[model samples]
Target: MLRKIYIILVHTIRVLAKKVGLLSLLESRRDRQSLLYVRSLFSIYDVDDMVQLDLPWWTFAAAAYVENFLRSKNGEANVFEYGPGASTVWLAKRARQVAFVEHDGDFAAVLRRLTEGVYNVSGVLIPPEINPRQALVAPSGRVGYENCDFENYVAAIRDAGGPFDMIVIDGRARNACLKEAVKHVKPNGIILFDNSRRERYRLAIEQVGFSPLRFPGLAPALPYLEETTILTRGGT
Candidate 1:
């Protein structure tokens, strides 16, 4: 109940902040820190209904919140959201049109309903029948997504050209996602990982010369709780 209360409070503040045109000027520092600490609360609530990838609720929340901030500041269009995570719903409010990709057909089947009522967002699972080599966008009025055993996702990218300005890699494969990320992500674009807790990601980010942008919380699972560490290729 306390968790719900906190969420309500945070959301209330957010609404009020936006209404009053002071969303970025409020008690945001404390609000951000306070929200991050509530990760333990969201973790127990089962975020599967929101996204197939299960991390902590606070982490997911933090990611969405930070993404909102970045989107507002940078004005990114043509975003390729690679993971089909909880942020897909959140991205609806921000992006003009988002291309959501989910590797698992079963999870995507369930998420399709959740993704509706979103603003200009397209949700499509991988392994398209027409083009088994590429991932499809949403509302194609198509059926039979055959993404179960599709391999060489990089080839799919090669087959489908993309100068995607923003690339979000929030898929289930945390550690190895970057290897595939390099193939699709544009040179000036960004690669944001939803659940960025592992040392491998940290090391890989450094090894690949990607700079850290933001890290919100200490260590929590909520979307809004975790540090939204962003890196724009070599730029911060």
Candidate 2:
């Protein structure tokens, strides 16, 4: 009941922000630029329905930061992502190759449909080994899906054949994914970790020895502020 109320309250605030120009007052200059870039590409769609959106619903600052990195690469970087969503579609258009792993079959099928024509993208579905409905923190200190194991899901990126230039950890068992990400990403690779505001995620990220550049600001279709961190692998 409290979660529902929080959701409603946040939604109401976001709507108010949009209607009353509150975004301008709250956003920094960099955040405003990022929001503009997001609108330029995805102004027509609602991101609440992730399967329906054609662009990544990441925080405006993070999304724009990534778009710039991809552009700088000139479509030559190989990218891997843990969660496949509009980011898959967005990446397919920019990267040399895009591979991802998803735990949700229904969402994976929708993603497959969306990227069917894009030959640069491929993904494998590795559903939870046990209960998909329950939640429990696994023994490895990874939270979420307590009843199931994601050992295989976290390791599946290795099968994607990378040494990838970029990896986005935006799925379940993210701390575990971050550990695996360190192994597969190129020495100079970029790791995009969403929701870095979480303490557990921040703690895990720090232990991995990456230098993080955090973007804390608005995301597309979200009212409240959030954070997405871009970690440079092999940071001293």
Candidate 3:
């Protein structure tokens, strides 16, 4: 299939980049370890086959960082994520409870199937409503949703009962999600914002009080470098 071929091509390019020393720019120990961990996973499974894996489909470096952070919480971390996928399973293994907010019904069913018997995990489905032409733009001003409004999708966390130890913003209308995330995360909690290199998202989070620590590197199944920023609320 076309998607499978694309995945192979991207994985080839990443291997080439690693060989040519482009990946050497990330010389930190943790960064190198993260890359190695992802490489180990790829050795056992195809790049396109990570959906069934227990790893988040994020930058390898960010995944490692989050793993360590979650481990430090002693199985007591309460996590809330905007998107649901492999991460829901991954977090449920480490955290006390993980509540993932999803906007698609079909995918929510798929996730529920994947998460069955994982009693500590729950899904909140808040589908995006169609909006009028003039109100097509998301609250964060991002366009191109074809009139989909994610206002309720972004605000669903408040109703999900959080002051969570960590909040992940990787779904639609991220700027609006980040603004709302600021209110729901515990004072010392962290926010994991995937693809933070986007200008609108970067600017929005920068304006918030959390200090950002960004990890840029290859991600599972994707071509080119991706950045995942972990922002800690309340203090430098």
Candidate 4:
């Protein structure tokens, strides 16, 4: 089909561009537009300085939706994020409380610095349980992937004191995160799953009976489109 060919061609072009350093150029241009669009969408004009710094993480669409959602809240919503990065700071600035789980100590340290002096933000580093010889596969049969600390990661999130108003599953073992999130998320709360284009994740979302509001498109600084799905209980 023409659509399939187009997708392949686009992917190939992006791969080639990255090899030649042109991808960065394209992303820089795309990021400016992304920032303007997200700012307009969220009515967050004071974050121009933060947007310009180019800290990598969170798609623009995802951030915009989150910012707008938080803005609509009562200013006392607690947030739990499976990954920590720019989103940690973003949530810290908006939410009354933010808790994030990171798998790397060094990254956690840096995130702490980024969120320092922000009393509402907290990061927990739960390193992966590293099983060098073990291979983990998704339900889609994708192989050669592993998240050794996945079980522990889920436990950490559950034990972190929830019913969170919002949960962002953008880190490792996201399917497991989704499963655990069902219990900890408050009624009518939202769960955001980044890169929901994966078949395994899609299936998991369906299995969990979430009514998903899907935002599928290009994210900030990325050369490709991905799905960022927001799931809510009772199909709301």
Each prediction's TM-score versus the true structure = 0.57, 0.76, 0.78, 0.72
lDDT of 2 by residue, 23-117 (tens): 45444332455555433232323333333343576777788789898888899999999987878888888899999999889888887888878
Estimate the lDDT of model 1: 0.53
Model 3 TM-score, 2 decimals: 0.78
lDDT per residue (tens digit) for residues 1-236 in model 1: 88787767656655665577553343343246454334223333334533433222334345554566557545455566666655666555565556766666877875677666665666656642345444532212113432322343323433333655566766544334455566666676677765466554566666656665655564443433455556566642
Q: TM-score of predicted model 4?
A: 0.72
Candidate order, lDDT descending: 3, 2, 4, 1
Candidate 4 local Cα displacement, residue 179, angstroms: 0.3
Q: Which ten residues in a row have the lowest lDDT in candidate 4?
A: 39-48
Which candidate would rank higher by TM-score, 1 or 4? 4
Candidate with more favorable, higher TM-score: 3 or 4:
3
TM-score winner between 2 and 3, please give it. 3
Winner by TM-score: 3
Rank order (by TM-score, best first): 3, 2, 4, 1
RMSD in Å for all candidates:
10.0, 5.8, 6.2, 7.9
Pick by lDDT: 1 or 3, better one:
3
